[model samples]
Target: MPLTPQRAHLQFGVVLLAGALLPALPLAGQQVLSVFAAASLTEAFNDLGRAFERAHPGVTVRLNYSGSQVLATQLEQGARADVLATADQRWMQYARDRRLLAGDAATFARNRLVVVIPRANPGYVEKLQDLTRPGLKLVLAGAQVPAGGYSRESLRRLNGAPGFPAAFDRQVLANLVSEEENVRAVVAKVRLREADAGIAYATDVGARDRDALTILEIPDPYNPIAEYPIAVVAGGHRELAGAFIALVLGPEGQALLATRGFLPPAPRR
Candidate 1:
């Protein structure tokens, strides 16, 4: 019998639906390792992920990037991942406190905050104090984010610096017109000219970013150095996760991270 148009359409729809579900199909003798890491680790971790896959055949590295707090919240809500890396000790502690970790979290990297301005210099920002200029639009990550917290702390420290005004931090905070969920979002808004300036990790201002951004370095004394922590997740693929973590803390991984502008882990106290 000749197929009718309606019946043919139904068969096509079923084929498309089956194709959509293909990702759910399992592959024999293959392993998947899921990693939940902070947004700031995106560049370095992506390189690390690729390196991990190269060394381990038949294994896939699934990476999830977001604000450190959001990652912690997701883990709290039962997100399935084999490894967790955060931009600060706070969220790593958040996970540890809730027993979401398989072992002690290791400090794997460090980063410092910097002020990023559009190359166009829309607000005439030349230095840290310029952040206090009235009506100057500024974007910052939400208070919950590690970069956001470090940014605020660094700003407050500026108040005590010799050249800055006593109300430096407060005035700067008043100019904030938007709060982003992650450091990258803050950088994106500043680059887009949606805001005059933003605070983000120094690593964010890559060669590509430099094309559109003018980075002003914060003083060493006033800068807040962020510590990054990584660990295996409880109830995850512990052995594979440990291998990944070892790679991150190893010479090959450290070199890869350095190429992407991440700092060596601070010396143990």
Candidate 2:
């Protein structure tokens, strides 16, 4: 039977409509991978997200970035996170205790602690110990941030440095103005000159305001080396999450991290 032009047009339209809807049908029904990571990983992980999307066109990688402690809390509350990257091992352990993490955490990056002061150096804290000088407003990260823990450890080590700790204790107690929620917050207070000095991660200080603040490098032995760990969340899109983790640990990811002032974990340690 010869088909009329009107019928032929209808058949072509139906075929085109079916083809257009085919690609979305399976994806619309598939699950998306949600990832929770530390705020410090924002820039690097964003790059990783784009790379993951390019590699797995059908999978979506949703990311949440914040303090590691906050991320841990969210995971504990049963938020669906396929991958969790923490700025410290402690949070990973905490998550593991709750069985929220899928596998043993792998250390991906190392960070350094630094004392940052306003660009003008109003406090004259040229060295770490100067942070203990009287009347200087010093801001530190709240106890929850890994940077805060590292800062406390470094301060304790400094205490053993010939009256440094006593001076620091007295000065810090007197001059302590604000304890921010994360390293970036602490850095911001200093950059804005709201606080005379602040302790923050090297990467956090690498932000654009770096020139607005003077960075005081801590000595190697006394400084606490912060390690960032990566793990997949159990029972939540594990395969896709694990792929994201692998990408983070890969060369391309590490290179991106290094450029942002994060150190790759030591080969032997």
Candidate 3:
């Protein structure tokens, strides 16, 4: 039967529609891998996210960064993600106790605390002793933040140091002008000179912040090592999550973390 012009036009339209849909077929199977990580892991994880995308075609990496406790609370409240990376073992234990994790959490990296002061030295915070000086405005992450806990622990150790005052810990705590939600916020407050000083991870003070701040290193004897842990989240894409974790524990990820100022995972005793 000879086709009419109207029938031919309809057939041509169908052909064009099919062609348009063809290019979209590959995207149908593309999946997003969600990662929830602590704020301190921002740079390292962002780089890892890109690397994972490169290693696994058709997969998109979505990273969510916040305080470890905040991330844990979010997960507890029903937020969903494929992986969770925390700054300390405490919160990973929190997830494990609740069965919010699919597997054992491995310590991937370590960090140490430091005190950052404005470059101009407005607070005249010259040494550890100054942290407890009366009227000194100090900012620290809230006690819930892993960095904050490390900071407090270091302060307590310093309090017992020979030269420090007996009430050094209490005095420093009394100097607190702000308690930020995360370590990054503590760095921000110090950079802005909103607080005379802030206690944050040594890694948190990056090259970008060097011009605006000065770091007073905490002695190793007084500084506590902050352990970072990673694991696959419960009900998540286990295979992909495990793969991502392997990448983190792999050479490439560890090298990347080293460049970001994170210490290698501590050797097991």
In terms of lDDT, the best-performing candidate is 1
Full-model lDDT, candidate 1:
0.94
Could you give the C-alpha RMSD of every candidate to the true structure, in order shown?
1.6, 8.6, 7.5
Q: Distance (Å) between predicted and true CA of 153, model 1? A: 0.4
As for model 1, its CA RMSD to the true structure in angstroms is: 1.6
Instruction: Arrange candidates, best lDDT first.
Output: 1, 3, 2
Ten-residue stretch with the least lDDT total in model 1: 21-30
lDDT per residue (tens digit) for residues 33-135 in model 2? 7889888788788888888888888777778998899999988987877899998999999999998877789999998888888999888887777776778
Instruction: Write model 1 residue lDDT over 1-269, tens digit each, in one string.
Output: 68999999999999999998887776556899999999989989999999999999899899999999999999999999999999999999999999999999999999988999999999999988899999999999999999999999999889958989998999999999988999999999999988999999999988898889999999899998999999999999999999999999999999999998989998778
Query: What local distance difference test score does each model get?
Result: 0.94, 0.84, 0.93
Indicate which candidate wins on TM-score: 1
Q: Provide backbone clash counts, one per model.
A: 0, 1, 0
Global CA lDDT of candidate 2, please? 0.84
Candidate number that wins on TM-score, 1 or 2? 1
Q: Could you tell me the C-alpha RMSD of candidate 3 in Å?
A: 7.5
TM-score for candidate 2, residues paired by index = 0.84
Clashing pairs in 2: 159-165
Q: What is the TM-score of each candidate against the true structure?
A: 0.96, 0.84, 0.89
Error of 1 at 2 (Å): 7.7
